[model samples]
Target: MAQRAERTERTERADAQRNREAVLAAADALFAASSSPHGVSMDDIAAAAGVGKGTLFRRFGDRSGLIAAVITSRLEPLRRTVREVQEATGSAPRQQVADLLDTALTFKIDNRNLMSAAEDAGISSPYQAQHYGWWHETLRTALDRVPGVHAPEFTAHALLAAIRADLVAHLLDERKMSPEELRSSLAAHLDNVLGAA
Candidate 1:
């Protein structure tokens, strides 16, 4: 009897895990498809996931809460990449800075719309600020390794502002800078400003 109960518990756990993955995957697809994740209704998400509407709220609480979870799920990869870059020691500060810049650009390109939607959902949302804090801390860690850098936190904030999606999009779409040139110029600008190399 105990063995049977244990097997049942395992099955329940597996089902719950599968349900969570489906919800997150459906949310990701829906969020990407919609103009904003906030634009997607809970019912729409449930229909997309093939789950009942009640299940979604039971699982995620509300639209903003679900969006936050989805964004957090997506950010794991970027966080992992930052960790990998940091673990790779022996690069000069300039090289580290260059790698960080590339990472920042890639992250912005990947997550910009999703984050914007998150912002449109609510002002008190913790998603944007938390993400900025993560990136800023990652940059600060990399900057701290430099031999003679001053004000690593300030430098991190500066780099973030300079390479953020809004600024990059404006520079590319409005000012007509190609991505490669923007990257190169910004890298050089940081190198000059931060005295990295």
Candidate 2:
């Protein structure tokens, strides 16, 4: 009976993992297709995932928690890449700063709508988010390695602000800047910020 119980526990864990993945995937698709994240309710996500609303709240706590989980799931791979680059020996700090901010800008452009939804869900300050803290620390560490930066902390914040979700949305949605154009502009802007070349 003990062995049977252990097997049952393993199966339960596997099912829970599957459910988690389904929820994240369903939420991702819905948020991506949504013009506004506010309209995509927990019930909608639960229906899409073939789960129940209770499960979503039990797993993710609330709307903000669920949104953060979805964003975190999407960012997992990007986080790995950022870590590898940040820890690499002999990586030029200025170029590292450029690469990091450019990647962030691209992500913000791609997920602007979902980000807006997050703000609507009461994640009002990006500065208050955990991921924002990680990016700020990581960028500041790289800035610390550069020659001329006097205040790595402030410089890191400034660089990150340049790629904020709202600004990216306005540039693309309002000003009609293509992703390529925005990227090119950011690159040049980074060059000035970090110095020539």
lDDT of 1: 0.74
lDDT of each: 0.74, 0.86
TM-score result, candidate 2:
0.89
Best candidate, lDDT-wise?
A: 2
RMSD for all candidates, in order, please.
3.3, 2.0
Error of 1 at 37 (Å): 5.1
- In candidate 2, position 180 carries an lDDT of 98
Native-to-model Cα distance after best TM-score fit, residue 34 in candidate 1, in Å: 3.7
Which candidate has the top score in TM-score? Answer: 2
Model 2, 71-171: lDDT tens digits are: 88888899998888777756687888888888888888888877767766776577888778888988898889889989999988998888877678788
Q: Candidate 1 has what TM-score? A: 0.76
lDDT tens digits by residue: candidate 1, 44-72: 77888888888888888887777778877
